[model samples]
Target chain A: MLRSLLEFSGINPLRLRMSWVSASEGKKFADVITEITKELQEIGPQQSYIREAV
Target chain B: MNVQKLKEEAARALGRKDVKYLIGYKKGSYGFRVSPAFIEPKEDIDQLIMSPLCNMSLVKYVMMEETLPGLTEQALKPSKIAIVARGCDSRAINLLIEEKGVPRDRLYIIGVSCQGVIDQRKIEARFPQVTEPAEVTEENGNYIITVQGQSHTVPKEELLAELCTVCRYPTPLIYDKLIGDKLAARPFHYDEIAAFEALPLEERLAYWQQQFSKCVRCYACRNVCPRWYSTICSLDSLSPQWLRRSADTSENFMFQIIRTFHLAGRCIGCGECERVCPMNLPLMKLNRKLEKDAKELFNYESGKDPKAKSLLTTFHTEDPQGFIL
Candidate 1:
């Protein structure tokens, strides 16, 4: 729902990625973060939704 | 349609030993304005009026009455509060009762089968510069609006509130006594949201950016929400200051996102927030988006059952987890 909202508001929904990580799953958290970072790098900076930039 | 029956019912409710007061709509001071009238005595029941213009939800006043101080321990006994409820207002009351926000035993809901209320702003814009008090009567799909000695007949659709346009429940879901003929529920449609969703992500963002930028941070949307009746909203708390007082687009976006998320699966599509917003923000779009998602994802429709637990409050082992990484 948050992703849909962000997408509707013109934000890159990929900028936000939710992963279920239990306290004991430190390796899983690291892997999730690394994957998100790679995706962000592929997507690059967010486009300006602010009117001034447009 | 029958003001006499409404008055009699209100008078009867007020006459009850347990009922403290009856909260309903009365005529406003000027054109197209209807104020919530509190009727204490049975004689004062004449002050109450029911019409398409009585769009403001009375459920908020019931919540406000609960939070007011100075009630003695003896006075705190579950006293009944009689409210004139439209379909949406009744739903709000049911949702409140379901969430334990208000006790059902202490409420006397006089439900009115609504034929949609007129949007006050739309009427004012159509008949501008009318200083005198106006009267609007719904007759056969037309609104006979009389202002400053001039009468204009306008199609109901032209001035009907947006919420009413797609209202699935026109009759109260739960009521002690219903007044007037019950209206059949309208078929729900999401074509508007679907069309918006069909647009490219950037375009959708740009559209919302313009709307969010117009926000002055008045918090009228939050104030008018029936579900957002928290005594101390986290957004307004000074200790944490979850939201700053800034009117910048980013801050406004954050505020809106938080507010909408909090209302997810709880909002009954009352559209009061969108109706009361000063910026004329398309808040219903955001709310309805969540509503649609909740329906599709969980088969949940809010405010329908008083006994059922809220969507976010309950979890199922068989719940869909495809969205989770």
Candidate 2:
């Protein structure tokens, strides 16, 4: 719902991602983080939505 | 449509031992203004009034009522309060109960089926400053606006509020006592939002950036919302300062986004936030977009059932997770 709302507000919905992993699934969590990093790099720097150019 | 029934109901509610006061509309001192009347025991119900000019939602004032800690409905000094409710206002009460902001038994809802309301701004713009009290009556899709010795007829469609045009619920869903006929709900669509969505993302961003830049950060939108019942808002909190006091485009964007997200499934479309905003920001468009999304994605319509599970907190086993990384 938040994702959709952000998208509607003209913010890229891809910037917000939700992932669920069990306590023991450390590898799965790391992989998810790596995947998000690659996606974020492709999406470029968010300008209008964020506070500063991080 | 019966003013007498509304007065009788208000008098009855005020006569109750537990009810502190009945909040109804009364004639304003000047033109096109309708004030929220708080009727007490000694006060006559003749002061109570209702019209298409009564555009402000009394639900926000109800939520603003003092609710001290450990003050249960049964134990409080003013155990119950009554208010004149329209279709949207009734939904606001339901949303409050669903979030535990207020108890059900503590409110006496006198329901009135609304045939939409005239936007105060629209009327003001059309008939600028007449200083004197103006009378408006609805008849045959026309508003007979009487100012001074002159009378002018205006089409209701031109003066009707934007939120009212798409209102599905014309009758109160829950009411302790009803005062008018129950009207059937209207089917609504998001033609404007759909058209906006069809535009390129860059144009959409530019549109919003311009709107956000105009915001003065007055917090009128936050203060007027029926669902913004937080005692200490995150914007004011030091621990996790959501947005700065600055009124720049970025900060305004943050403030609005946070607020919009907070009201995801709870906003009942009273459109009070947009109504009260001094900047004339298109806040309802943002709100309605979320409403449309919530309906399409979760198959949820808020304020329909107070006892139903919340949309954001509850997850179905078969819930769609296409966005999960």
- All-Cα superposition RMSD per candidate: 2.4, 2.0
Q: Per-residue lDDT tens digits of candidate 1, residues A1-54? A: 777777777778788877889999999999999999999999987656332322
Q: Which runs in model 1 stand beyond 4 Å of their true positions?
A: A47-54, B70-73
Tens digits of per-residue lDDT for model 2, A34-54: 988999999999866566633
For model 1, what share of native contacts is present? 0.56
lDDT of 1 by residue, B1-325 (tens): 7889999899888878888888899999887899999888645677789888887888988888787778775786548888999888888988999999988988999999998998878988998877777888999999998888888899999999988888888899889889989888787688898889889977887788788889898999988788887777878888887767878777788888988998889888888888888778999999998888888888888998888889989999887776677
Q: Model 2, B1-325: lDDT tens per residue?
A: 7888898888888888889888889999998998999887878789888888989899887777754567565666666889899999998888888888888987999999998998988999998987898888888999999998799999999999989999989899989998789899888688998888887777888999999999999999998898887888897887777677878899998889888888888788999999889989999898888888878778888887778766898988887787776
Residue pairs clashing in model 1 are A9-B205, A10-B205
- Model 2's alpha-carbon lDDT is 0.86
Q: What CAPRI class is candidate 1?
A: medium
Per-candidate DockQ values are 0.50, 0.65
Question: Cα RMSD for candidate 2?
Answer: 2.0
Candidate 2: the clashing residue pairs are none
Query: Best candidate per lDDT, number?
Result: 2
Error of 2 at B157 (Å): 0.4
